[model samples]
Target: MEQAVPSSSLEQSPLQQVQARIAQAARIAGRKAEDVTLVAVSKTKPAEAILALIAQGQRVFGENRVQEAQAKWPDIRTAHPEVALHLVGQLQSNKAEDAIALFDCIHSVDRPSLVTALGKAQDRLGRKVPCFVQVNIGAEDQKGGCAVADLPALLEQARSAGIEVIGLMCVPPADIESAPFFALLDKLADDSGLPCLSMGMSGDFEVAVQLGATHIRVGSALFGER
Candidate 1:
């Protein structure tokens, strides 16, 4: 008879499982997992929940709102200053300064007005925050990203406004095939000479990985259901 092994040791934490999936996806794409950055989407998760992942070695996180992030991250940052936070939602023109103060990166820059606000904030604060220009790949009116037709003008405006535009971010239409959308975003980023692509989420991140996603925002896959 074969010896029995410990069942406890066979189970993997959610974070580990996600990381393993990321690695597998990267390998399938002939890419290094180290080249991919997983932004643990901690938006709406409580402080305790975030700390659970922190204990599990997740150092980068994504939050959707400035006020909510302010309420949660100050103490968390004090405890773990190495944690890098990204603002991964629609940023309001009024919240630019606050967003600048809280997030290490802003991934929702879509309009010229927002670019202007962020630029002014960066100037007044005497610090610069790198930003990802969110592109509405599917051109959905309800979404927050800029329209495909406006991308060039917006990028130019952001550059002239002095915002550190680092790359592009997008959210594909829900319940439809996301690969084509991801592929388009990848092409758009490449055409614009941007080096980073912040696409993918809990469900379609693997596809995003295969298409050159530098950052993947994973929420439930890493933290379990809300």
Candidate 2:
């Protein structure tokens, strides 16, 4: 993994390089770079790495587990007080409250049970997290997204439960052309009236930007090998 380097500005660091790529992609797609939010996937990276990026003005970060973020982020947030943490992994229904307590946004609300759990947690804690309903865009059996057909029902359930679903998220089948999957997600978001899309990663993010991805989760590209 690339060691986090302090004082790395937008001109030469890996983070800056990724940001530049996103901007170039957006420009090529006729969209403004500022509209595409780059969520640095900081899962498993140490606090030093996170703090280094923070010093570089990276306020948005993503984590795979609530427990991990809880352990490392409280002190960091207490110090910076402006960081936005997002949960970008499969979240168990039982962990809804914990997820809500730490993450400002959640990108894995895929089932009715999870929606119900999150709803109760929100009501009890008075904390509302902007959510993204992950879509099994490739129909992969092993993936964690909601099947394409079930999205509408699940979204309705979230609406009834007062969960704020902000967008659609997906992990396309690996080792294949991701554009089709990204394009499909864009269409699904349009049909569902969602304004944002959290698609793309280290490999296919530029394609995702061209296809209307509002948020891209880039991990290895920014932090190096996991």
Candidate 3:
């Protein structure tokens, strides 16, 4: 008879599970898993948890709140200087400066005014922080993103301001699968000449990847429940 394995030996760590998921998604997309970045959404997760993930070779992470990030940044930076941090959530006008200082990328540039504010902040910091134009693909009232029709004009304005518009980002309504939303963003990216598409999360990332997601913002799947 085969010996039974212990639970401790069988259990996968959060980071391992995340890497597996990324690999699976990439396989479905016909792309290498290394080609897609997994931005571990570390918003409210503890410092220890983040460190544990870092120890497992997960480098990129995303955070939602500026204040929460501010509380976590010092230690995370000190311990993992190579880690790339992204602000994947909404940026308040008041926190734009702090966000620019903390994140390598801000993935939620939804409004024209926010773009202007980020441009000013980037100028002050003397660094062109990469960013994504958030699109409300589902047209949900509560979400913050530029309307689909406004994207072209917005990209044009951003280009003229010298802001490096690297890609498009969006969050589909809670009930929607990410395929359609991601496909729409992919179309928009094709039209705008941008290359990156930031979509997908814990529940729908597989769909996002198959639809051509270059960057996926995965949360609970990596960190396990908020």
Q: What are the per-residue Cα lDDT tens digits for candidate 2 across 1-226?
A: 9977545453488888888889999999999999998899999999999999999988899999988988999999999889999999999998999999889999999998999999999999999899999999999899999999999999999999999999999999999999999999999999999999999999999999999999999999989999
Residue 47 lDDT, candidate 3, scale 0-100:
91
Model 2, C-alpha of 144: deviation from truth (Å): 0.3
TM-score of 3: 0.93
Pairs in clash, predicted candidate 1: none
TM-scores of the models, in the given order? 0.95, 0.95, 0.93
RMSD of 1: 3.2
Q: How well is each residue in 140-188 modelled by candidate 3, as lDDT tens digits? A: 8999999999998888887776788899999998975567778888999
lDDT of 2 at 53: 93
- Best-to-worst TM-score order: 1, 2, 3
The local lDDT score (0 to 100) that residue 23 gets in candidate 3 is: 86
Candidate lDDT (C-alpha), each: 0.93, 0.94, 0.86
TM-score of 1: 0.95
Which residue ranges in model 2 land beyond 4 Å of their true spot?
1-11
lDDT of 3: 0.86
lDDT of 3 at 25: 76
